[model samples]
Target: MKFAPERSSVALFVALTRAVREAPVAEGGRSLAYDVIDRLAKVINTPGFKVELEALIALGAREPVLNSALEPFWQELHMLSSSSSAGSA
Candidate 1:
């Protein structure tokens, strides 16, 4: 079944988060979560990526479960974006 953008976004986020968390450690004993989050923070600052990220966050805000689940990452992205823009200013 085809899902709406918001629904798909939520699902994708959930899946990625779970997969990253479950991924076996290579050598550092660290999960992919940190790397993923760091990359995501940078991606969110790009024009197209920023738009997509904002769309997902806006939809998440209206969906209770996703909103809460995505809160920390969303907040971090926003903080990073703000700092990045400020630095460029």
Candidate 2:
């Protein structure tokens, strides 16, 4: 099934989060860990997964396979919550 752009973005964000979280902390890899953490923080605070996607793209993610591999739960939540908020407003 095809997903909206926002949904695709969020799925990618969640996949990235899981990958980072599952990655083993290597010895003498504090810098790498910190970088990953920073990226995670930025992604989490981003208004939408598109921003996270753009960031990934800027980081040289050009392969269709790689892009397709990332999930889009971020976009899903953004849409769901935003719609709920709008309804409440």
Give me the candidate number with maximum lDDT. 1
Once fitted onto the true fold, the runs of candidate 1 whose alpha carbons sit more than 4 angstroms away are 1-16, 19-45, 83-89
Q: Count steric clashes of candidate 1.
A: 0
lDDT of 2 by residue, 3-89 (tens): 555444456455565644444433333334335435644545344434543554433244333333333333553454455445554
Q: Which stretches of model 2 miss by more than 4 angstroms?
A: 1-14, 19-38, 46-52, 57-61, 77-89
Clashing pairs in 1: none
**TM-scores of the models, in the order given:** 0.41, 0.31
Worst ten-residue run, lDDT, model 2?
A: 60-69
lDDT value, candidate 2, whole model? 0.44
TM-score: model 2 vs. ground truth: 0.31
Per residue, candidate 1 scores C-alpha lDDT tens digits across 1-89 of 55333333345456547644554434232233444444554464454455545655654555445455555456545654565556555
TM-score of 1: 0.41
Among these predicted structures, which one has the highest TM-score?
A: 1
